[model samples]
Target: MLTSKQRSILRSMGNELEPILIVGKGGITANTIEQLDQALSARELVKGRVLPHTEWDTRETASELAEATGADVVQVIGRNILFYRPPETGRSPRIDLSGEG
Candidate 1:
């Protein structure tokens, strides 16, 4: 879980970041989840964009991705979803500004 302040901070930082991954007509898949896992390992926070043509609902996709990637849902705005996971070894702590914590 993330605190509101942390989520707010991440959201602000996320604003400048472009979506690194795009969900298309194929929708979320095992391969997609693997890629997302890799991405989360490298970057604690990642933004994913759901293509307009995607058949999956935004919330559903977000939930699936978050579950697969072991990440927390920071925010979902329009077709974009924000995901966060703290780094291993406790090197970098995930900051959540949503105040969910």
Candidate 2:
């Protein structure tokens, strides 16, 4: 889990990144979760955007995605969500975890 400060730092680092995936009107489907799981494994940190037509609340969507993917929610700003997971190889990762690391 990331502390508030770590989340803040990650949010700032994530600001320059474009959303790699977009959840459309279909919302968070099983396939989406599966894809997100893979994405988190490969990238560690990722950003996603929610389309305007999505009926789910942004916070709810972010939480659901995080839970489904077993990732931490770094931040949810506007329609965008930032997610993070440490690499599985047990190497020291450069992810700014603030004091939480």
On TM-score, the leading prediction is 1
In order, candidate lDDTs are 0.85, 0.83
Worst window of 10 by summed lDDT in candidate 2: 92-101
Q: Per-candidate RMSD vs. true structure?
A: 3.5, 2.5
- Output candidate 1 Cα RMSD: 3.5
Tens digits of per-residue lDDT for model 2, 1-101: 77777777788779888888688989888988988888878877899999887687888998999988789988888998899988777667756565545
lDDT of 1 at 93: 59
Sequence-dependent TM-score of model 2: 0.84
Locate the minimum summed-lDDT window of 10 residues in model 1: 92-101
